[model samples]
Target chain A: MRSDLVDHVMTVFGAVVRGLVYSMLALPAILVVASSFTSSDTMSFPPTGLSLRWYKKAFDSEVFMSALWTSTYVAVLVSIIALAIGFAAAFAINRFSFRGKMFLQGLAFSPLIVPAVVLGIGLLQLFAWLDLTQTIYPLLLGHLVLAIPYVVRTVLASLSLHDQMLEQAAMNLRATPVQVIRRITLPLILPGLLSAAIFAFVTSFGNVTVSAFLTYGGNVTLPVQIFTYVNTSYDPVAAAVSTLMIIVTLAVILTVERLIGAERLA
Target chain B: MKQSVLNRRNVSVAVLLAPMVLLLTCFLVVPVLGLLRSSFLPGSEFLAGNGFSLTQYVRFFSDSYYSSVLMETFVDGLIVSVVCLVIGFPTGYSLARLSPSARRWRTMIVILPLTLSLVVVVFGWLIILGRNGLINSLFVRIGVFSSPKTLLFNRVAVTVVLVQQFLPFMILSVMSVVTQIHPVLEQAAANLRANRFATFRRVIVPLAMPGVLVGFNLVFVLSISAFITPRLIGGARVAMLGSLIYERIMSELNWPSGAAMAFVLFVSGLGFTAALNALAGSHLITKGRGNAL
Candidate 1:
């Protein structure tokens, strides 16, 4: 009877804990989405009445639109570059044993260990010294450094999981190494590659620390723009822009869930 | 003939490794080295000279204000990490015990916040924690407070947002280890007449320590270096290392001072990471011995 009471209490305790964790993670985003539809101009709770005026304002803002564009293209560019570089590195590290191979692996993974603020300041100073601060190249390269580590780590995880027997069997059938790789190896690791690309895109899109320093003139990314905008203004328009971000992030995450189970991310 | 084949293999390997090596060298390694070099330059000659000096370092160490910022960053990180552990461990334990489908739904809820832009997340918190925001309104409506209070732009608001920001990481880290712990361990403890609490205290807590340690370290490092949340939520009053570094560079144009602060932040982060590594290593050694016993 005592054990039964303990179990009952534990069960109730667990449920309450679960509910709290769930609400803490999900409620803020939901509130932002709800408040974006506020008819009132001021930032009020329970959001007054439901309307989309803030959404219209967010859409009409040129600064927000351009920042969104910059963020998109930069994210796309970062994914492609990081994927290409990480794939080659992963292939070498997995398939061949060579001198400095461990060093190569460490270098690829180093960015993950370094603080993003340090990287941001370093890149900012480096570009300023070179007079390249005005151009978008620093942003591209800074994000590339941040994104490449994820790509390499993901691709390496994928490569380790894949069966090498298929490549060996293909080679025994008189297939060239390149042919074996293209036909057997590539297809097997394609999911990892796709996962890596998606991870890179998400990281690059969500980045602000590194991008904050690299942004110059009118070249702010969406997060950086929103950050600066929020500092000055505290209205529903910020919520509107944030709601849009939440939507896009949700779409990407849902797609990733469909492609690869979310468990692998943990 | 053997040498020629070896040469060809080496060439292919070099080709495969070149791009990654070059990119890291040019962008990651060189830039950091450059920043370090600049930090050593005299603050007066930071923009122009190549001469090495430790004036920035001296000033940083000598000044209480700067050291206080650094100390606050670590203290905040420690507080948030502890808070996340107290709250997040149950969530992870729950996740590990759930059915696969239920875990999937819960995992999505956890991961969605991580994938969303930090700016968006902080903005949401701003609205909810502001003067006339949701929590205040609810409190006032319930007569808990006579009026709406300015809850945002303070340490509590900053800490709350950071806890939310990093809780998913802690939960996932703990979950990864907790799921590895077999159910029979707990069952055996129960069979030995240990109650559920005893089973948890003796069987579960020891096993979950490694994950908890890892999650704690990650949360510490991330929260320490986090710029946006503290800046947006903490406002101008609460100064952190990341924001101080930003001010020195962007607003102050004091590259040497900023670079020095960056290196200090990196070193402190490295210090915490090393401490965690030591903790994890000792835990493994003890666990191995216990198994043998």
Candidate 2:
């Protein structure tokens, strides 16, 4: 009984510690927004006054909004292409016995092992060779390389988790091959696909290295825009923009969870 | 019927593999090959003054500055990778054993930080670890310290942020391996009068070692190439290999020399990976760790 009591107290203490750590981790993100209200000339902590002027400046800006749109467009495209091709390859590897099975996986996974900076440099060189420098194509290609491994991993896990017996049963019932895929496999793996796509979007949306080489004067993404702007100037406007990004992201995640039931993902 | 079904499966596999093959060759293979060739090319007419030379390598190895930066980056990489595994294994195991419903919620917390971009995540850390940041503020609140703490612009800050950022990869990698170890195995061990720690130390750790190695390799490779994290968080104080390459490409515009630096980064990644693969293939780990593994 004494030992049981000790274990119980330890469990409670562990829970409290975990909560405290998580809260501390979360607080810095909140401070990014809260500090925007500071009326001081420098980025002083513990502000004395509050205002929405910085938020206003962030919204009224032309550069920030256009970059936001450009990122939005590219992220969506990356997600779609990455899922279609990555999921298909994952399905093939997991579902079939073939020569070069391990080789295919190794090939697909190597890009991720290549660091983003080196891969960025490589892409810049290749694109320059092809006379495609300073364009969205190279950036998109670089992101696609990074994204493929993730899509393959997630979709392959989901695909393998599903029982093969179902596919056999579907075929035994005279369902067409396409029908079996559409009805059984797609539904089973939809959550993984969604999660992978969402991740690809977020990753590309905030990309730096690959896009840094690829961005023309008029084609900035949110992160590149923020980095360049923040380099020369430190102000509440950058803070406001960051806060807005955080808010939008949280909203999307919660909305997606509510719509599809977040449990499906795990 | 068997023949027809086999034929159909073959066709399906080919169809599925097509796009991935093309994109991979274009983006992955071509570029790596390009990197190799570029690294070996002759220096510019200016640097070499008219001929091919081994001078790029002579410069890289001969310079203490470049060699030390490369070495520090690898050391930091090893530390970050090992730390993530140390923390991630238990967390991953807990996630795997939990009731499936509870796992969904837990996974959310695990993956949430990962979904944020590297820049955004580092930006968040900058605020907390910056001068007059949250840690210092809290320390003063409780009378732990009088002045702001020094966290950023140091080796410690780089490791902390890198560990936090890359931890999810470690967890996910280990989780994949751990989830494969059936609970029945553990239940059987319990039936034989083995204690929980004994079973885990002997049985679980051995089975989990491969995943740990994979996670280690992945994290080490990633950290070796990490630039933005070290740059932003460690400030100008860091001398990582990635920063060295950045200096050449961004500052000096010496593309050939930068290519040499990039090759060192590539070779370093490959060397670590080869060692990890050899470790995995040898199976000598089990013999050495017979007490725990």
Candidate 3:
């Protein structure tokens, strides 16, 4: 009876500690979102009366607006291109036993292991030598390299979980290879494809290190802009922008959760 | 007929892989090679004129300032990794123990922070840790402190934010492996007259070492290479190797020196990853019953 009480107390202690740790994980974002609604000019938590002035300020600024636009289009393009390349590589890897398959797989996932700072400097130097540093190509290409690994990983997971016997059964029904892929394989892996695309999108969208190096004049990404802004300024406007970013990320996450479930993505 | 079929298969495979290979070669491989080449060049050349020299690398090694930065970067990585493991092990164990539906929502909470941009997350930290921010104001109001302390721009703040940022990766890694450990083993251990702690220490921890090592490797690599968090929170006061490299390349316009340092960082990261893998192979494989990894 005494040992049972001790076990119960231990369980309660463990639960309380776990609860605090999870709260600590969540506290920063919650603080940022709460502080964004401050009525005063200075950013504060337990905000000094709620207001939307900061959000209005963020929206009104041309720098913030243009950066948002740049980030959106760059992310969209990167996601599409990454999906195309990742899908092909993932499919080839999953479906066939080719020579250098291990090497190819390693190369595909190599970007994840390399530090973003290293990749950023390398691309910057390469673009400077090629005299293409002035254009938006560096930013697009840098983000593409960073984003592809996520797409490949997600698509590969999706493809591996897929069964090939269905494709075989489709072939036995007199379907052409293309028809088999289109009719059976594509629909089944659509969730994975969508998940991969979303992963690509968020990676490209949230990138700061590579974008910092590659973003040329008039082409700064939202995250880079916010990074620069917060370094110099301590205003609620930055908080407001951060809140919006959080909302967008949360929205994307929710959509994926609804479509495929977050557990599967993990 | 067999020859034609074999040729056709090879051709299709090559065609499918072509675009990805081309992209990686052009952007990833060529640029990295270019960086490696420049790292061997004289600092005065600015990546255009090429005279091969190890001056940049020698400068990095000889300069106490640069070497300390490198050391500090590794130390910071180690600190973050250790803390993440300590906190994440329990969270991940509990997560693994949950029902499927319960686990899903808890997993969502963990995943949410990861999806937010690093800049946004750091900004959130700034609000909380800034002078007159949440902690200070609350403490002062409740008479815990006399005034608002300088909470931002320090090693502690940087470490705290990094732990928050990377904890999810560690948790997810641990949970993935923990979920794979059969419940029957725990039952068997209990049936053999083992207590809960004994079961956890002997059965669960050994089984979970592979995941723990993987998580440690990942968090260490990421924390050392981290740029924005250290730069924002630690500022110039506690600059890591990443912030130093950024300053050299961006502010000073010293490509060769920056490239050399970047190369050093890459090699060290790779070295640590390999060392950990070897450690897992030699130790875990011999002792553990199955290859958990």
lDDT tens per residue, model 1, B1-293: 99999999999999988998999999999989988898888854465867788888899999999888899899999999999998899899989988988888899999988888888888888778888888899999999999888897788889999999999999998998999999999999989988887688778888888898878888888899888998899989999998888888888888888898999999888987798789778977897578548
Q: What is the TM-score of each candidate against the true structure?
A: 0.95, 0.86, 0.96
Per-residue accuracy of model 3 over A64-85 as CA lDDT, tens digit each: 9999999999999999999999
Best by DockQ: 1
Please identify which of the two predictions, 1 or 2, would achieve the higher lDDT against the true structure.
1
Query: Residue B106 CA error for candidate 1 (Å)?
Result: 1.0
Could you tell me which 10 consecutive residues in candidate 1 chain A have the lowest summed lDDT? Answer: A257-266
Candidate 1 docks at the CAPRI level of medium
Quantify all predictions' global Cα lDDT against the true fold.
0.88, 0.75, 0.87
lDDT of 2: 0.75
Can you give the lDDT of residue A241 in candidate 3? Answer: 88
Q: Give me the candidate number with maximum TM-score.
A: 3
Task: Compute the lDDT of residue B246 as modeled in candidate 3.
Answer: 89
Clashes in each model (backbone N, CA, C under 3 Å)? 0, 0, 0
DockQ of 3: 0.69
